[model samples]
Target: MAERITLLVGGRSTEHDASLHGYRHVLSRLLAEPDRIEVGAVCYVDRAGAFHLFERAPWPEREEVLLGGQTLGPGAALERLRAADSFVFSLLHGNEGEDGGWQGLAEVCGITGNFGPVLASALAMDKHLQAVLAAALLPGLRVPRSLLVRPGSFDAGQVLRRLGPGPLVVKPNRMGASLLTTCLPEPSPSALAAAVREVFPYDDQALVQEFIDGREFSCGVYKEHGKFVDLPVAEIVSSGFFGHAEKHTKGRAKILLSPENAATRKMRAFSQSLFEATEMATFARFDYIVEGDGIWFLEANTLPGLMSGSIFPMMLAETGRSIADLVLSAVSECGSRPARDKVLAYDISH
Candidate 1:
């Protein structure tokens, strides 16, 4: 029997549009290989946190608001999810989608899916925490030095002092796709204050790191037949630091299918180490900054984008694995995992 598959895309995050692209890309790829699995439904979680379902995959651009269909409220969505014999491909990015909230929901509702376990997703989402974990697990790993700025307690002077004298990268600690991320020439108190203030509305905590001017690269890690393996490294040559524009906007950045240079070898090793240390499941992507031979650990994306042009898919293509291949592999591995007891009600009877 063909496995029922639902691609969960769009979310209440800055990366919602990117998720839409990824959904369309993956859905199209899966459709091309029809005998492998059944593409059942596409669910779009809009910016306002509403669940809209489509019997057929909605047009990526036109599918914004919940159209005239069976709009699944929170409870209904959960119930449907728990009851279906389907693989939920969560192509969501940032915050509630990728920052463990969705994974936690699956855990609470006992739904089987890919991405990773709840703890791994939670650990990988926070920049500061992931860096701290890498430092502890992989000693001498050159991670960028940074400090966390919590809400209502962002002291600019204190932040500048910790990060020291250098170009600084200020970003939301838990956000991805480089949303609200900025680079300053120097970690001046005023600049740091302004950046943190801008970042605060999106997240409760922000990360400030010393900017390292180096070659940017990303490598993918995935379980092939139950063993973790590294994908090809893609060197990102961007006009500037790869941020929102470079990521979402086409032609803003160039990707090179790099050879097995010293950087790629080290990155592959780092990717495996980070994946193991984080206890990541199924798949992940680790980003790095290479300054000569010294590789600086940037971050790990638990739910990396699967858009056709995205680095993850590009790396997979270099390895001769299509999007359908990845989806099939995930389904084969995750389909048998025992489901958790579903939550029947929320106790909102007040």
Candidate 2:
């Protein structure tokens, strides 16, 4: 029998809609390669956690939200997922979604290429911890001076005592997307406390680092069989820094050709080290900052946004790769993995 496949899209996060857009991209490529695959369903788990199979009546173009003519609810999502022979999790941005929750569930039921288990997923999500891990593996890499703030017990005053006054960049320790990132001038002791409270809403634990003003850049890396191979480097240009809107909005962030420089070489080296250290699988993207004479590490995205024209895909095209090729490379590598066989949950026990 041909293997049954289920591609899960959407999540309860700020980027739920974006994930849906990415899913359409992945599904089209998968459907086109009919000789090598079978489709069980392409389901959408709405931002509210409501699950529904792709219905033709809802979406005019059936290929966009194409389905197997079977509707599944939230309760049935995982059940049907458990029964599939293969799976694709086309999620983008957000804590509950890409941060690892869905991948964990996929593990329990059996789905291929769902990234690592909960801990790896959990560890990779936070910017602070990612820095901590990167520091261990690539000591030569430049990272900003920063501090980690755990939930409940936070005092900006105490933080200031260690690295005092002015020019601070603070972000959530556990979340991705520049959602609640703050860049502040030197603040009075009283004002520092308020700023700390501001970041509290985003993450219980946070990382406040010394500001590194420079150009933002990212590199996408895919697995060439078993070895890690680097993709084209795309520099992000924005008036300020590349924040949430820049990443999601069309034409906000610019993906450029490689700039020949020592800094980029180091950034690539740093990226490869981080990927190996973290044991990232299949495809991933790393972010960086190029300062006057140094490049600093930024957190990476394991599941980068990939529509036909997204940055990652755009970057790949410069290297003479097509959307069809990109999808095929990723899916073929993922399918050949042992994890793919272990996780494709076509049958779930109640």
Candidate 3:
């Protein structure tokens, strides 16, 4: 029997809407391989903590949407709980779902996927923490020493005195998709502080990093049951630094399979190192910047977007693998959890 694959999407992050778009596109691609997939389902969690099922009756084009065990609740919409044989998550650029919070819930209920536990998810979710972790693996990569500043953590004058750096990047600790990321150049400190206030609504903690300017590029990697699948490098060209509008708005960002320069190779090397450093399983996207003689480590997306034009699928296609095949290969590995011993029904394996 084909396993039921729940494509969890939409979260309480700034990228909630964008996550939905990613799910829809991924759903379309997975349907292409009818022989392997079964019971397609969508679970949407709104900001107010309300969960809703996307479709009531499966349409002709999407006849595999299973409603048997699915239900909506405050923060989760899941069926079969511990009984689910497998799950394929596609949450992008946001909190809740991608921030390791959702992964924690999955673990509590014994649902494992490509990535490890919630600890890794939480560690990889925030750009600042991920940067600090990458420092050990990708040596010499330019990373601004930073802090996870929460509300009332510091005063502006005191912060500047502590930083003592040329410029800084003030961003929400957990938000991706560049919602409130601001480049704070010196002599105009108030502008960045103001941007910080705007981001306060989304996250209680803000990340302040020394700004490093250079060429930005990203790469993808998929680690299955002891197998690593590395795809071609893809570069992100933005009018400015890759921010919210640049990623979502057309023509603002350019994602290509091949790089125009040698810097991309350095990016791939660093990406592989960082992935191993973080102990990331399944798949992820690593972002970087190249300066004169240094390549800066930016961050990694444990759950990189798998939408139609998203970088992960693009790189996979470059390797001649269809989205359908890639998604199955990644999702199928989640069954790696050791078979439960009937004698020890509740013995947990770490």
What would the per-residue lDDT of candidate 3 be over residues 179-222, giving only the tens digit for each residue?
78887767255765686788788888888777777767787877
TM values, all candidates: 0.92, 0.82, 0.84
In terms of lDDT, model 1 sits at: 0.82
Tell me the alpha-carbon RMSD of every candidate. Answer: 4.3, 5.6, 4.7
Candidate 2, residue 293: how far the Cα is off, in Å = 2.9
| Deviation in Å, model 1, residue 83 alpha carbon | 0.7
1-350: candidate 1 lDDT, tens digit per residue: 67778778788888887788787788778888888778887777888888877766543435634344568898888777777768888888988888889988987787667756888888888999999888888775789988888887878888777667889999999889889999997667887888889998888898988999999988889887778656889889998878888877889999897888777887888789888877777788989898977889999998898887888888788778888778878887786445556668766776
Model 3, runs deviating above 4 Å: 1-3, 54-71, 74-81, 84-93, 112-115, 259-262, 337-350
In model 1, how large is the Cα lDDT of residue 172? Answer: 92
Question: Which stretches in model 2 have alpha-carbon errors above 4 Å?
Answer: 1-5, 24-40, 55-75, 186-195, 250-253, 307-309, 338-350
Instruction: Please give the lDDT score at residue 145 for candidate 2.
Output: 87
Sequence-dependent TM-score of model 3: 0.84
lDDT string for model 2 (1-350, tens) is 33345566666676666676777776676567666556655666665666666423333123334333455675676776666555554454566766888767767766554455566567678887788888888877778889887767777678888876557877777766676766776755576566667767766877888877888888887776676656778788876656667776777866676765777777777877777767666677888888887778888777777866577877776777655555456566666756334455587789
RMSD of 3: 4.7
- Per-model clash counts, in order, read 1, 14, 0
lDDT of 3: 0.68
lDDT of all predictions: 0.82, 0.68, 0.68
Best by TM-score: 1
